[model samples]
Target: MRNQLAISSLMGLALLAQTPIGQAASNLVFCAEGSPAGFDIAQYTSGTDNDAAEPIYNRLTEFEAGGTAVVPALATRWEVSPDGLTYTFHLREGVKFHSNKAFTPSRNFNADDVLFTFNRMLDKAHPFRVAYPTEFPYFTSMGLDQNIKSVEKRDPLTVVFTLNKVDAAFIQNIAMNFASILSAEYAEQLLASGTVRDINMQPIGTGPFVFQRYQKDAQIRYKGNKDFWAPERVKIDQLIFSINTDASVRIQKLRKNECLVTLNPRPADLPALKADKQLQVIEQAGFNLGYITYNVRKKPLDNLQVRQALDMAVDKKAIVDAVYQGAGQLATNGMPPTQWSYDDSIKDAPYNPDKARQMLRDAGVKEGTELTLWAMPVQRPYNPNAKLMAEMLQSDWAKVGIKARIVSYEWGEYLKRSKNGEHDISLIGWTGDNGDPDNWLGTLYSCASIGGNNYSMWCDEKYDALIKAAVASSDRSQRSELYKQAQHYLKQQVPITPIAHSTVNQPLRASVQGFRVSPFGRNNFSGVSLAE
Candidate 1:
């Protein structure tokens, strides 16, 4: 039986493919580090959610592999107005949504699908938006509704979006995972039933893979879309995502050939993985960050002096060497160096424990005051070892005569508690969804993100205004200046100390080909093929 295929066999897959199904290279397996909360990237911004939603959906545009160049996806082509406030997209013809045990699409992708998909996110009065919970986290954070005035179906193949104001990030922003096109017909039927289940579980999109089933925290299965638009189709007929939370277990499974690809192996494991002849390690400087956030709502943390003291006290180089194993660059600002308009002049605070102690004393903060330090329980592409980083921080704070108590919760609970301003300080970070600087400063530091993804709860009106003005202009020089000024506030106030940008390491079997990981750290497996 196919189920009994030998995991220990040293021979190539060509020898096993005597059967017709095997000849088609019909099966592939992957070991994902964590289970997704759900499949909707629009509702959630975590990489875990991206892992679940990305395979089943297609956006109007997408970034090229390992770079930020905008490329066409579901949309064959597009154009922008001279004013930069209007965008028109030409939809690709004959692209079919996946059909399976779930509901199927009655027609090909068109302007109506784009209209329905975006309108539900931007228009509160839309039937689907009114029928269901209408929180699109990433879209709301970007304030797309305020920026986007209207989405109109110009024709069967053409759709136009008119923005209330100019946005420099518009083109790149639309390519984000949050902007994934939904199958309008499928959503309409589900809403009509008056009980639409979680869309992630039964996602319907015009992508290359069809969602088969998901056993939460266990496995996710998919079948290749035979009606895919690409001339070169998905070479693997079947794909299985094995959920293994423990990194050691994932590495063990990969070594045993139980899985062909593994995600987020620790930095310490790089030497062994590189030495292994059976595997190929793919690592790149990711567009991501790992940092400490000071909750401005708290007493000691609210003080700028205390925040700066903490920033200066912690040695980022030590953390980088110990945690990242030299797999990344030390971040000076919130945005990673890989992103455009990154203000390199805003350097990291000097590691001076003496100055930190003196600053705390001058701020009237007593030595040895107990404060909570929250650590992340899960490993992310940006943060390889949150607990280790937290421990390192605690040791450094002690040198500054501050008593730090390390605390941790489950992955979801940690994010929830941190967002609610429940901690004095927290370990957190972000992976850029798009190449835009507004994605970093606007979504993160702006007042709009407070009480949500902005864990620090430190919102400066001037900082907000700078980013607001930055997004409003199409001029690169003007936007760069505004972003640089906005970053100056972060450097001076030290609300959130920018830490390090990781080099994401995704290891795969030697036989796996066409598997390119994006610089934004998204997983795109549509182009992948398994060979003997």
Candidate 2:
């Protein structure tokens, strides 16, 4: 049945490709790496899921295309109080929300939509939350719920956010994908029809594209939002996500003209891709980190010395050479070197198997200690080939008397199990959501993120305090010092082994234009179009 479905899907794609370049010139088919978990960006944290939501939704603030600088979107402009506790946003009037067969928005994007969007995540007793229970992973991981004292609507066109404390990254935090706005009018319509859950499954937002249909693990289709406030940016008439998990398959689709753009191309394929006259490869220093998270909650790994010994055993350079193939730099800190406040003075532990073995002995760890190494199933910009990287680490650990058993599940299951502390060690990585150090240090290592993005399940009060202090201070130099201290503290704790900071490689047909590789590792097709 699966084989038949694959063939049928391929056949449909071939038909799509047959639509003459003149007739289908405005249509874009992107060979995405995987299926989105769902359309509700707030409910998930993965880039794959965010890619699905990018066109369908717009945040009050948005990171500029190809850069991390925050700019206005739904909200035309905003004001920050002198005390840094209150934020007032003036909404852009006449912004129309996308409509589906189920619900049509009677009102424009307003303060009510902002309240409904955030309140559903913040208030436990919110009507939408009560009808369809869910957790906003990114929102909670970043401590937005705790930091935000209240969200109040000043008027139909203005909204106010009062923070419990000064948040230095407040603007950048809300500009992330998880903060994509939803239409309150549409939500109310769904609630009245007793189908509130459809708000996520059938999304309605005020972005450049309108949601049309989604065939799980196959394809998703959208039409350019004719009523979009920024209609000039909606260059393409149609956008399609062709879900293809295999890197090789996506490359093949790109070569065959079945897909105009493809993501995370295998590192070995870069040279040939760049040499190809028919293709254009875009490379950028990724604001990302690939790391091996030691589940500190697990028995042997709970020991700091054991974690340090494991970190010493693996050769990050070898993995980078073999896996990334010259497309990455060795990462020595929890956050990437490109990020501000990154301490270059911090050094990684030397790769010495003998020293690692002795350290394990000193820590009272037995020779041949067994551990399960969970590898990712999908390709991310930070880690091109996680399975191969896992095997390399397994071999490196074996030399230091550690019996590493490499295991993997489907992409979604792998993340869920690892986040639930099911693995002794897991291969995971992150692309910075916003250009903030807190987005990395806070979201991944902070105490509040323990059960969510913090797969290490490790937290220390002093480390948490440092990050918290960094977030509370608006002063750059002070925040940098605090973040540096936190990095030093992380080096001593060794909860995770920093692997590499990879360069993002995006390959598309030469005919494709206006597609810029996002620093945040998301694909946005707003102003992208195809040449005849």
Candidate 3:
């Protein structure tokens, strides 16, 4: 029998064969809580729902995911101009969609759908236009509509994008599943109606699955698109995504054969899972990092000394071991080891309670000063017990004469409070959108960027300049150098302390095959199935 592969090891899948039988014969059922935050690919704003969105929608291009190759999805091939400013995509011909009630044999896949998708992203008049908050900085970091001068449909199978400035990573950005193509017909319908209810509940795409029904938190289902371009390779007939966020409920279901797969397993559940001879527990590092964020615009945190004091005081390794049960690795500085941009030269803050005490004293953090820390009621991304983690920090900081209060809010309310920059400190984490460093640094730290994700209000002009220079450069060597400099500066500033680089923990039944993990914490559900 072949050795069981770690989720991360699946990234280098050169030997995996394509099979017609696999796509038609297999059926896999899984579970996740709630539909993705939203579903319009253009206005599809949140990171959580790609599990359902990715297989239903396809991008012009695809990143090799865990590996280094740039694989083609919708676009058969593409070319970056010599200056790296223009990208022309040569679309594949004869690609048809799964038959739908609205359209049969799906109209020929063409540039018009591609044109509508990009234009919708840049259209300020659209209702969903407000979905992309100006506070999320990477919109400009990737230089979206601002850098693109025009997108012309060269032919039915060709589309060209002209940029205001050279963007070396423009092609990679397109690989973002968020850029999934939408039918011009469907887009027009949406434009006329001004509501996403129909599309979100029932989406259309050129990928492996066709939407069947969405029962809100109860379940979401999709039928295999046998006529899909890669039908033979997909090997799955149906998908059932169930909602089971409660760890105990999920684990019980997994053991009873109620679920074929599960994610974000609790630490206590690991031993029992591992001991279960009938089931398999696969472990790998996740791409997420747990960290504390301070409102730089707010008092106390505005002072670098207080931020550094909090950074120095906390015991990251202890938290990792006790809170996470050694499931995750420790973070050094701000970079994850899995990322190409991580600089080994950058080091984590030493855990010294005394140093934290001295720094707090220097900042005049009085004994009675109550610092409130914010977190969501349910654990997310890293440190499954974010509320508990906050409480731990509160106790630790108290030893250093800082009175910290831990607060929990619902996910939506927590997000709202953080965005308004009202918290003394908030516990947060991020999963990298792609391999690029800008997803973390540039998107979160750029100066007062519109739609900026950097809610901490941390800004450094020099750091911003380096990120700009890196993106603007088509030269690989020069761009890398610029990124290195930006990382170096980021370490010195100590905006958010680096937590551990996360490992993907996706436990599947032995019958489930072709399961793989993407850096973005998404599943390529098209290739997954129950081995018959």
Best by TM-score: 2
lDDT of 2 by residue, 91-142 (tens): 9999888888877667678898999999998998998889889888789988
RMSD of each: 4.2, 2.0, 7.6
Please list the C-alpha lDDT of all candidates, in the order they appear. Answer: 0.82, 0.90, 0.69
Q: lDDT score of model 2?
A: 0.90
lDDT of 3 at 384: 71
Model 1 TM-score, all chains together: 0.92
Least accurate 10 contiguous residues by lDDT in model 1: 8-17
Pairwise lDDT winner, candidates 1 and 2: 2
**Candidate with the greatest lDDT versus the true structure:** 2
lDDT string for model 1 (8-82, tens) is: 221333232233322346677778866776775677777777877887888999888667889999888999999
Q: Which runs in model 2 stand beyond 4 Å of their true positions?
A: 1-12, 19-23
Displacement of residue 20 (Cα, Å) in model 3 is: 25
TM-score of each: 0.92, 0.97, 0.87
For candidate 1, what's the RMSD?
A: 4.2
Mind giving the per-residue lDDT tens digits that candidate 3 earns over 372-424? 88865554556577767777888888878888887876554565567667787
How well does candidate 3 match the true structure, expressed as C-alpha RMSD?
7.6
